[model samples]
Target: MKISELYVYPIKSLRPTKITEGKLTKLGFRYDRRFMLLKVIPGENENGSGPTLKNMHIPEYPEMGLFQTEIEEAKGESEGDTSRLIVTYNPPSSSDTKDNTESSDSEDSQARRLEIPLEPETATLKPFTVTMHSSPTTGYDMGSRYNDWFSACFGYPVVLAYLGTNTRSVLGTLAPAKRNNESWWRIWKQELVLPSNGHGNKMLNQWLVPFSLGYLVLNAVSWCHGRIENGTSSPAVAIGVTALALTVLWTVVNILVNRRHEARIGFADCAPFLVISQTSVDDVSGRLDGGVEVDLTKFRPNVVVEGAEVAFEEDFWAELAVGSNGNAGAGKDSKVKLLLTGNCVRCQSLNVDFSTGKMGTGEAGSVLKKLMKDRRVDRGARFSPVFGRYSFLGGEGIGERIRVGDEVVVLRKGEEYTVTGKSASEAWNVILTTGY
Candidate 1:
């Protein structure tokens, strides 16, 4: 099956975009951990490097997109500053401007900038101290836990997983389809689900107390025309994947939408964009304030992983190589099919710091530099099951990758074979090993 849809969350609890392409990096993705989280430092010298992450109960920042942000590799190359992504957000408004006006005027802006309008609660930043990780290629070790930071406060480092044909096709047919209640806000608020309403612009600005990890459902639609959220799912709203996708999280009975009127959403009304960003395991790593998302200066993980069904779905790690690390040649697209027997779960992010062999806590100790600067998980850790708690392939949930375009070969052993999707470097993603 090809990728039907893709999604990414720039901030933890806010809405996200349905993106098509992104940059993959060892810290996760290039701009993945660019921004970070912050707690109000009670009168300290230079924020004590910002945020007192000393095992504080503050789970995450709900709103972290209001302020400004930037990252510079040299601080002077671009605009006399290092090469880095600058972030900022707008406050919430009841007017239709946030919905209709701004969107109409910015169609040309998205080409040169990532203008995701969101609310914020606090703000703090660093010049070039961010680190990241991304992808599910062949050699990527899964169990290595490396503390991750991000563009916003998020629970995991995520990439958009999409099957364009499926997602777009569903919107085409599901009309005259059924649906549950349209009270999406109440449902999501109660379920603690994040909103992927369409254009990936939902942001949270308050505290998520008694907070539990929540996620939006990104399903692999079989027939976009037939699989409508309120049509087949949402009978009670709190059902399994149905409610999850539409942000319906109430404990009501499942309710299907009456197949009478076809509620069509125009590409302009709610275009999908993926907010691909990194996340750390610390409770404080995924919170929002006003709109800014920050890291608690003290948290760290071992390994980081990025997975996608549309592009990097098969033979991911195997098909991938760092920009300057190897032959640096593009790959061909191929496909390998496998049976996913378990229930479909769409929310998963991996981050660990095997750097010290122990997943350390608290800002009591700090790694002033980036995660790559740490020698523990990066070099000292062994590539064993105990350490690679997560692997690029051959494990639970994380199936193997298969190319799916053109220009390629077929390798096999026993009942296994390989597939490629493209022949160009710009699109080449991964390589996969088949089993059965």
Candidate 2:
């Protein structure tokens, strides 16, 4: 398969900016999700209190998907290598009636825009705590201007933070605790914190503690209290058990099955790269109603490839070596290898239309339901339907660059076996022996 398109989301949940070429790093594409929005939890003090912010995902606020961002790389000899991040807000202004000139000049039709230097050398980076995916971490606030722009777009109090020093291991990537300990549970979310120097905060030290056991008791009492008081649904016990089991299984599989590779990922979901196929989008479009057009954009994939024989063929691929002109083994210095980490599960976020921020409900043009009918085949993640594959840059290709039209050559294919087990230990053995 050859790459047909490329995309980078400088901020998570925001609209993607298409590019002809992109540099691949351990943290996915360069500039992808390097910045993010965090909704300020109301009525809370953030003074060293581990940042009173709840991360925003597209499903919770579909309007965020309407905001688009583009990168303007510095030009000329004096400008150096810095790139500016330009954001454009799409408002509810358009022209479907007569008087096209008037509609074009109308304020509603005009898009609000702003630009910020992505990696400014002259600016000072102030350290502040923030949360993402329920993981408490530190980031540098991008001043009040960027925060204000996002607040105006979302009509809510929010902040824009750069992932300056935040470090994260993939969810379920670490080995679970063999024994349950209340102390570990109390500080389960502490694993998300970035290691620091001697200087520290008393409030942060009081809250962030070491988590080395059992399940991820992310923020424990505080997290649950906030969610419950805010009228959010309490998590089921099954979800915790499943997550713990999967983490253990994944740890074992990594040790016994694939021990040589190192996994480095950032805030781009489960892995560093997500790949989708044009054939898969075509297949989904055919299944949906005639009026509903299912494009590759809805999936928000980083790399889009073409020439797959059938839909979901990417599931069996274990590794891919990317090279120019669809030739992975063309030369030694020009190849970038990627290891397929796991299958990406679908969620209600896919129901949100990219062009329009509206979302479909229930069975009415629901992409989730259509995917569940035939794509629920991931052994560990049987609860949700699988679509694209999550992967990581591997071997000497950690800093390599891949462009549109590059060939994606599969290196390994996984063995076929059904996961059968009632307990977590049994499931771990099944996963390692069967080679999922």
Cα RMSD, each candidate: 26.2, 16.5
Q: Go through the candidates in order and give each one's C-alpha lDDT.
A: 0.23, 0.65
Q: Look at candidate 2 and tell me the lDDT of residue 125.
A: 62
Candidate 2: regions farther than 4 A off: 45-51, 76-81, 93-111, 121-123, 134-136, 174-262, 326-334, 361-364, 417-436
In candidate 1, what residue range of length 10 has the lowest lDDT sum? 427-436
Q: Write the per-residue lDDT of candidate 2 for residues 366-388, one digit (tens) a residue.
A: 88788888887867656667778
Candidate 2 local lDDT, residue 202: 46
**Could you tell me how far off, in angstroms, the CA of residue 215 lies in candidate 1 after the best superposition?**
54
RMSD score of candidate 2 (Å) = 16.5
**Which tens-of-lDDT digit does each residue in 320-380 have in candidate 1?**
2111112222223222211111100011011111222122233311222122232123111
Poorest 10 consecutive residues by lDDT, candidate 2: 173-182
TM-score of each: 0.23, 0.69
**Candidate that would win on lDDT:** 2
